[model samples]
Target: MPRIRSLFNPSGKMDKLVFVDSTKYGNHTRRAPRPGLKKGEPALKRQFSRTKYLNDLAGELNSAFRGIWPAKKSDLYQKMLKRFRKEPENRRGLLLMQLKSMEINPRYTFNSLGTCSTTVKELEESVSVGLQVQAHPPRGKYDANTYYYEVILFTWDDPNDTAFWSRQYSDWIRIGKDYPNPVFEFLFPKPSGTTLQWLLCLRVHLGVEDVVFPVLTTTGMQITDVGTFDKDEIRILEQRKQEEEKAKKKAKAAVDDIVRVKAKNQQ
Candidate 1:
């Protein structure tokens, strides 16, 4: 039987292990995440739960924004393994993964974290669609409040996560749980990042940083009917996106064919 190693040396030789707690940084530096996570704050222990949620959300949003849904919305966002088992390989998996992402959760609704609260601390009823898409000044009820926001409409989130895209790479597959988990990053150049400045500013002004949407932890998550205003917004965005995608694919195909023929002639 063989035993494992414990120490090492500077001369590239073996030596005893040494334990050192090194800061070299500052105090306000983050501590082990206390189930709370904010940008810029450094913590030794990562917010793993948040990590999983963000990864899954990024996967869903990236595809959903691109207008690709494989199964009925109900079956689409389940964990990859569970989703494949219930739906067809062709009709299921990545197709739905993409589709689920493209969807914008309703205003009275939310996905992942929780559902919308019927109450708001403040709003400009002056801007009529009062119950619909308009974002208010702040919620008066709580000392601090966070409102859910989505760029295209009711779905609330920073669009940066949406930018990590699958392009001319036409073939799509479900990000599998068993395989080396693929990390999805949608990079937003410069001020283009949707999650950071704009959304965060609005959320902070509304004092919602301390609040959490109630639906995420609840057992049953419900989907509300898309209202007249919400429906129009969703339809317009989807149509525009579909048109853009078709144009892109057509252009890519033409370039690919030309390149192939030119290579063949050269050969």
Candidate 2:
């Protein structure tokens, strides 16, 4: 094969000559055109099937979270396809695991501003999402008062049934003051299936001279089997309670022994 340094023809074809673009060689010529695969070949069928499945899964994810953050849609699509391709056997499980920790913005995380603890509870009629945010005062910016924050609660029983709730705080957090904890209860019917997932998004905004730029970060979790979830939570609480009681008894015994020793010494 001969490499073409500069070609007048952009199409890479002129009558009998055929040109190919290769990363290794800028533009090269092949002696004869390679034979194309037959229409019903097994290898070709498998390739097509795999591509279709991955594309469908990616499309479903994009549709589920459509319009939540338009700027990152393309990146999200590519990432989902890459992940599905990597684990062909367990695409759905792997994708859900990956989404739990996926960062919306690579530059900064939501925890940088403050700390947030999220809890999801499954009620008989609805799901309750409780968020406790401890926001810190502005740093690095001279005008701290111009900074504000927003919180968005996103939940879905199934991909088709999704909900979003948002709240904005105009006042900046001051030192030695408490940031209000917000609890948003989403009225979503219990999933017929066993699992539910929710995503919490935090955005920080800086306004200067009427120009505003927002930084976003998101974290989410999946709850499978409501019965199992409640049981585990109750078990954990009971264990902690038992441990605390044991510690209190030990401390009281030590105090009583110390008092007896002091009395004996004085006598």
Candidate 3:
């Protein structure tokens, strides 16, 4: 019977089997993940439950800001503001995520994250607005070939606010989830005739559509100078993007036709 070898040298000229010291050639161990780096299930539940009432409020606010600045008194903002002020309790620590380019220019690809809190704690509010988008393979309800995503909006304000612990998110949609982004509008409670500066952090998960994982986390800010917004601009930008995409497809088709003709001649 032949016995299996415990150790062997590649030289094949050993007088006897020699033991090799594995400890002499060791690799570094990976660093441990930071605390709460990827932990937030209970947090998500709190966020969803608290925001269930705010969904309608958000829609109304978005509609109010849909058109031009210096809106009329009868505008949606005025109507919604009345409703906001009448609500029983004020919900602070609202973290907001917005796709900036969709409101500006398509060539611009920056997104934004911001939060709202007590005026006295403005600095804390600015520092705590960090949110990230994460993706997972299509599962259950996310049955399309496209990957499903979870966007977590974090705030450092009063830990009591459910949203302070949970993440706010949008409906899972395939459209406007990629580059050449979507027009995003966030509505927050603000006093009339005031300008406030907020610090924010935005993290985009790159390569999610292709099953690869990487994230780009950035910090910046935006100023809310007025309550009015122009919805017409968004429509114009969307039309422009559609036209540009059509032009590119036309040029590619022409090139493909030329290549096919050349190949036929060669044959």
Candidate 4:
């Protein structure tokens, strides 16, 4: 073990050497040679292929939903990798299912708060997603009088496409003597491609005064049906375009409001 006392002593990697910082034993340096895969080895090639696919998928997912993940980025990535490894034959399908059911916050599940039901409808030129949430009685410390929920929608027509369409709805739902049932509807143009998959997530928030904070222990997520449509049938409705613009503005405003609140509190 060697101590790193200089301004730039390296704490990650430098060519053939790797550096690590350990609290108990101090800084350590070791030789970690990068291994290259040889040609014609089918078994090793398959392993490498799987590893790369998983890594790329995990990285994309983490990047796409950076601020929304319930757990640490590394932990979530490792969990997805482990689950995918268990069913190597059905990695894509398994990964989608796992993500659909993942809780943003494990300590307080969305189901504990209420019942959520979703419906998907495929029309001639567009697809519609409807979400219905029915509130339940307050349980434990989650009994906030003024709490709201937000829905996140992510859609991609092509698996290879790096850009995707996203929209979020952040409406406050006040809990009263009678539990309220809030319904949300989202519409997206049918992709010109052969297939389109959309991921939808529900997040609950607690409102204190003018500050709104996410509930770190709830989970509500689902992957909608993948639809196939003819390229000729693709058309974006003007109303849908307006709705998307509105959603984007609302999302930005929500983020800005949270930032302002945090800054005010710090002051």
Candidate 5:
């Protein structure tokens, strides 16, 4: 027999759902702007990504009982429209601040110490005398040339916090007579003070170090290390493997003794 089921649902309404063909049936390509551009688009559209939805909302609010409702600019709806055009910033603008320092302050001191280094033989001679790679027409963009210098870093914080890192300016850059030293600068889009402090402390005690850039951030002072890992991590792995090998040998020897005793008993 043919299936006999209700044409309507239990709610006594027609069991209906609007089915949409998600696959393009018509000119869907004309709906959006060209990639990588918002040129010549409406200003409101440029401001808000959901321009279509926002416009629809505005239309719905205005269409209420046309004569019964009054049109006024000072209304709450207008205020909402203004917000739609441009949003306000949060009280706390950003968590991280970028660094900026065309010049390094040699007098600057932190964590109870100060130091510098470079590729030039003369710079590494003493703790105080750091060799600034003279602008022998330093190569690269704006001829910025700097070398890496590694060191140990240590740090702590109140209550709870992550560690910081710091390393020597990787190399030196050519500066005018006005600026005496080749200032070791930092990277951009820097971390917050809390984060930077954690990074700077890395220089105090890590096998490898970073070249940090001083940056100004929404979250306050920050330093970004420009260093890589060191050989110490590799040495650690080797030590662990040796310990495992020793344990394995001890287990094998015990198993051999058990086998030998069983053979003797059989004899």
Candidate 6:
């Protein structure tokens, strides 16, 4: 006698999940274009200007760090000081962490884009940004082999509405070991009253696998303080993540909905 196995699982279909941590991927090898000099001018002049700007910024950060670490007497600063002590070798990293704690805005130049390089230009109503994903070899055996990356251009309007992520652009780019880099252009809708900022979101998933969830990676054109994001907005983002997870748990289609949208557009 043998135990009879059920044909279907009582817990329902299992969702396929693949998490790709962008930080683990590290930065791309390709370099941004350097500022060029005319025939008679020397390159050192431009170099000196950049170095001077960096030094000034570093000095400002150092001043702020000193004000908080030793001089300020507070429980929060005391805890931070303990962590800061651990990074005795990495001054720059410690400075960045301090800046984050202080809610300081990061300097975002036109060259902030990662492997997917972009350029920004001013527009009448919306900002225009061009994205070009650079092709590269897969990281490891666990890396996705057959996948389509989705690009969503979004603008946050009403805080109360769950549909704040009104998809301005919905498209997908198929990628693998040999796929070519895809070029995409998006226009984020401008907001009305307050300052309007546009976010470009990239998500990827296996095209052939059913019950699969997407791995999201995002970047934006606007340069603002990290701590400025509202709690309501953060809640909405968390809700979006939950919805994605729920969809995966209940997904029955072989190809994800995003891939279908791209294919439908092609037709």
User: Candidate 4: misplaced stretches above 4 Å?
Assistant: 1-39, 69-74, 90-94, 137-143, 163-165, 189-195, 208-267
Winner on lDDT (3 vs 4): 4
Candidate 1 structure lDDT: 0.31
lDDT of each: 0.31, 0.49, 0.32, 0.58, 0.30, 0.39
Q: Summarize candidate 3's per-residue lDDT along 26-71 as a digit string, tens digits.
A: 3223344554554456876665565554554444334433332122
For model 4, give the 10-residue run with minimal summed lDDT.
225-234
Minimum summed lDDT over a 10-residue window in model 1 is located at 195-204
* Off by more than 4 A, model 1: 1-78, 91-94, 97-141, 144-148, 152-267
Per-residue lDDT tens digits for candidate 1, residues 1-267, read 754333541222123332333233211222344333454455423444345544565455435533632222443344433433332322211222323322233231233332222211112221111122223223344433333332122222242233222221111112123323122222122322221111100011122453443432211122222222134444654786899999999999998887433566675
- The full ranking of all candidates by lDDT, starting with the best, is 4, 2, 6, 3, 1, 5
TM-scores for all candidates: the values are 0.19, 0.46, 0.21, 0.58, 0.18, 0.29
Candidate that would win on TM-score: 4
**Pairs with backbone N, CA or C atoms under 3 Å apart (clashes), candidate 3:** 66-231, 67-230, 67-231
Model 2 — which ten-residue stretch has the worst lDDT? 218-227
Global fold similarity of model 6 (TM-score): 0.29
Ranking by TM-score, best first?
4, 2, 6, 3, 1, 5
Error of 4 at 211 (Å): 5.5
- Evaluation by lDDT, superior candidate among 3 and 5: 3
Report the lDDT of model 2 for residue 32: 50
Pick by lDDT: 2 or 5, better one: 2
Q: What are the per-residue Cα lDDT tens digits for candidate 5 across 1-267? A: 954544542322222432322233421222333454664467645546455444543343334212211322225344334444442321010111111110112122121122333221111212121233333222223232332333222222221333232234334232234544444433312233221121121121111122323321100111222111223433544675899999999999988778433566675
What is the per-residue lDDT of model 2 for residues 135-197, given as tens digits with 9 covering 90 to 100? 543444434333444544444444344333343343443422554543433333444533344
* Residue pairs in clash, model 4: 108-217
Query: Which candidate's lDDT is highest?
Result: 4
Per-residue CA lDDT of model 6 for 1-267, tens digit only, reads 954554542332224333322344532233333345342267676556545544543444344434422322234333444444443223232222333322111231112322455554446776566766775324233343444433443333343221123234325444454567777776655565322223343433342232232322121122111111345544655776899988887685544444523566675
